[model samples]
Target: MMELRWLEAFVAVAEELHFGRAAERLHMAQSPLSQVIRKLEKNVGSPLFKRSTRTVELTAPGQALLPYAYRILRSLNNAMDAARSAEGVPTGRFTLGFSGMHNHDTLPRITRALRENFPGVDLNLVGGIRTFDGMRQVRNEDLDASFLGIIGDVGTPLRAREISRHHLGVVVPTDHPLAHRDAIPIHQLRGESFVMGPVDGNSSMTVAALQICHAAGFQPEIAQAVSDPFLIVSMVAAGVGITILPSEVLPILPEAATWIELEGDPVPFSHGVVWSDDNESEPLQAFLTILDSIFPEPTLQ
Candidate 1:
């Protein structure tokens, strides 16, 4: 089979019909350009050019093959472009896994960064996974990667880099007596009903809250099992119950509810970026590079 370079020379010469011009267009010496066309003609078992000192012309076979040459070269160029689309380039889509809080807290920034730098790459946001499920989805290739709030030490096959560590806090109605305090002991809430994620809530925040309550020496009275975090805050604001969440939740707390610091030794809640070890796509790699730059290890303030 003839190589692409040879066909390229043949096409250039055919189009220009002038050795000097073709050579210049190809950025090659006239002698080599002539040789490449001759080699192509020999491979095709026909003369491709009718040449003289003053000019050159494509023979009948050359004319017949010209369209084929153009098509083949065009196809090859398109194939090369397809091979280069990082995540999807020119126009590509990247699937990113995001859990509840990170959708607002983290994903928007990352998606914006990627859009600005790589406008061709669309960041597909997949949400609603609980902490551990995010890790599993990333490992299983159901998601390209995820930002998860890990509650405790959990082993995972996916690669992870913690973005932030949050100290636990209590969100209570503004009129509540404890809400006036700057900080409160977890144990002090023993008599209070808890508004929390469902017992089956997939969130690490939920697990951490339950664990903190249990560690405080009591099983909280379940005021409600609400999955929507903001709604949980609404319930608290309505005085239905108080709840424990990360300090980061302070920003989104309703006016009726406020976050109080946990007064004691801390076992922090951490949000991490997790991805499959087996994922090696160029686009995914590019996203990972950008992610590391923006959220380098232990950059928690």
Candidate 2:
């Protein structure tokens, strides 16, 4: 029978597309990795990869095997997690994803409440590329849940529980002319050298900012592309550029920058907790209950 270890080696290699790099990722030697791949191919009666000195490509069988391998491994891990939860030890670990955009006002309260109520649960928090990435991960059973800002059409697939809303705000340097305004019109930002995050993938902030800019009648002349929203303040303070973000980010504003409310509700940001339709974990259910206690009128979809 083909062993799980052989599948693990194959998956690692397939993902990395290089035996040496895959070996390093697995913290094993190339010799052993090669041995395992060969053993797997021999056991399956076919070569899973076509390798040259420069590149590694998956064979048809390899392509067919990857998804099943991932699903099997995930199922095994889930079974183990379930077994641990059922051991009568009264201790469990629940992993949830978090984007930096979550509300500071409620998360601490939520965490504290969870700790106080479920003393046995170790609330595992993982950071993500974006909130929507968490939704994808949840669907894959990689996470139990996540807290993130939902944007247009991105959170449609996952079951979203609305936690809070944060209207868009303009983040600018203290000395910038717009800093003096109570709020600024979107089109007034035309021709400004804006700092933007990547809109590719599930980056809602970037998508919303660009959409707002387009509505305002021009594409922003981007000065810098930053990944983290918190870092945008420093860039703005350094006179590199300005950015638009959610009102929830106000607490993190440095002395060099301040926020002005946007002129209209162009595109507002909503904080939501997302999970897969398949998730029915106890810890996740407990979390939903605590969330209900905190925000009673929570909207679910």
Candidate 3:
């Protein structure tokens, strides 16, 4: 039987296609790496590489074995992880990032479920990170996962699973004329002054607000831009300007502002969990399993 280390060496050399670079990558001397490759080739009864003075190329047998080597290594890693989890070994700390746009009650529930299933895990919850920043963090392995309100593309090496959809609404001061109405048509707010968060390219809330306004056939007039969500809410309550927000976020604010349903077919926004597809850590896998159990399907809220 071929040893796992032999496959490891084979894969490293096969991909790098250079004994010196592969040795450097494997943290060993070039001579030993070459010996391992020679042993592997002898075991297979076929030459694996066409070695030259300046270049090393994979032979036909090496080409056939490269993919199998990758699969074996990956499977061995998964098996080790599974064994560690089954033995209840501490999976270590996990960090979750969010932008505070998700449902208020959802975070606690997710954390609680993970704790119940894996008591050995240390949980760290990070909030107030913008969606785009969170995406970058996840891709770079700074965050294990994040609750994202993605309005557009999710980018590569990262995947998203949507949990809920929210309809658009408008928030106005209680004393504002539009606040007295049960609902208002989208086009009625055409000339109205709006207060919102800064126009960061990745802010789902900002993009959703702008899209709805443009869909209504008018560009909104901006009065102020604030970074803090609560500050934006305070400005609206102080009669600085009305702003558009998802209906789910309206309930958490002070009662000084009133939420009016938007008339007409306004575009809905999505809220979901985002994580790096490349992450195969035990804790992240457990967290994802719990999240899926809690939110089996996307609900329109």
> Best candidate, TM-score-wise?
2
lDDT, candidate 1, 1-301, per-residue tens:
7999998998888878898989999999999987888888889999988888887888899989987886687556445545866345543456787766545677777777778877765578886777777877676565778888865545655677788777778889999999889888888999898898888757888888888888889999988997777788899999999998777777777899988887887657788777866555555666776787787665333
User: How much lDDT does each candidate structure score?
Assistant: 0.78, 0.79, 0.83
Off by over 4 Å in 2: 1-5, 12-39, 42-45, 52-57, 87-93, 101-107, 111-123, 154-157, 265-267, 280-283, 298-301
Per residue, candidate 2 scores C-alpha lDDT tens digits across 103-157 of 4567688888988987777898786447667777877666878887776454434
Please list the Cα RMSD from the true structure of every candidate, rounded to 1 decimal place.
17.3, 3.9, 8.6
- In terms of lDDT, the poorest run of 10 residues in model 1 is 85-94
Among all windows of ten consecutive residues in candidate 2, which has the lowest summed lDDT?
Answer: 84-93
How many steric overlaps are in each model, in order?
A: 3, 0, 0
What is the Cα-based TM-score of model 1? 0.68
Runs off by more than 4 Å, candidate 3: 1-90
> How would you encode candidate 3's per-residue C-alpha lDDT over 79-186 as one tens digit per residue?
666666787654666789976646476888888888988886779988887778888888866688998787777878899988778887999999998989988988
TM-score against native, each model: 0.68, 0.79, 0.70
Deviation in angstroms for 163 in model 1?
A: 1.0
Better of 1 and 2 by lDDT: 2
**What's the lDDT for residue 207 in model 2?**
81
For residue 108, model 2's alpha carbon misses the true position, in angstroms, by: 3.7
